[model samples]
Target: MTPCGDTEGDENCIAAIEALFKAYGSLRYGEEVTQLEHALQCGFLAQESGAAPALILAAVLHDIGHMLHPDAAAAVAADQNDAHERLGAQALSKWFGRSVSEPVRLHVQAKRWLCLRHQDYWEQLSPQSKRTLELQGGAMTAPEADEFERLPYSREALQLRRWDDLAKRADHPTPSLSHYLGLARGLLQS
Candidate 1:
């Protein structure tokens, strides 16, 4: 089952985490990275940035939407399908509050912004990054940029971007499935 609340050591949380692990045992992407791995790297980077527990959770779950559905990453661009950020925000909402969701939403925009603004950051991105850049509509006008900047999350957006850059798979260790229980526990209490 999809873990929701802060169940901590609760049976539901355990089951959820276990389910995730069972799902992850030997899963591998065809030629790309796995969602689980990407998320863990993002989480570790968030931790190194000293953001917050919830933000770490946000980064961890940010790409979880891809796990839930196929072609989700592709669906995000050229339409309004922010599958990664949107689904992550909703799933995390059950446990974390806006702390996690807000950042998730902004981070997608942050990636787009970084592509537009931060040249050095863009040049270092992997091939997958280049593809996503095209998919996410690399082209944006000044007015569009202005609206994006108004997204109530300039700081969070930048923070997420910085960590995302830091958390590339080569540099970071693989993600772990151990945090689900603790996160569920927190939600149950709150």
Candidate 2:
């Protein structure tokens, strides 16, 4: 059964999501943009690219694990890998299906995969990303890349990663968090 199968569960899920953003959305993990801004920008990019609702949702919530981390700023400051991808996906799985959660689970893998698959991808990474890449296992090995490619939602994860790489611009305008939550509510209904 879905996590938010009941009306009360859905309300609780929505409230939890709202509370999450409200509580930690201002935190940044070595990025110029705040967590909320990065999320909104990524969601906006997905919308602009005409991604499906699930993908758009995935984009918006992919980095939520960062906010969820107990001390993400400290983790980043220490150059540690928080494994936010897995954490975010696990949290989201309660309210969303694989289409939304799996991409989040594998977005970091997608970054590693892209570094191996595309020569220029590594060069495109910001210094912070490059530092985190080492913490995240750097570029994928051949076997790892193959495994990542075989995973379901791998392509979507790659798309999400690309948007993630571009979402750190400060002062970028985006739709309010409520707008994306509206999408989330609609997704729950359908």
TM-score of each: 0.74, 0.93
Model 2 weakest lDDT span, ten residues long: 72-81
Give the clash count for each candidate.
Answer: 8, 0
Question: Model-by-model lDDT, in order?
Answer: 0.61, 0.88
C-alpha RMSD by candidate, in order: 4.3, 2.1
Error of 2 at 29 (Å): 4.0
Instruction: Give per-residue CA lDDT, model 2, range 74-162, as digits (tens).
Output: 76457568888988998888888899999999999999999999999999899998988998888999999999999999999999999
Model 1 scores a C-alpha lDDT of 0.61
Which residue pairs show backbone clashes in model 2?
A: none
Error of 2 at 49 (Å): 0.3
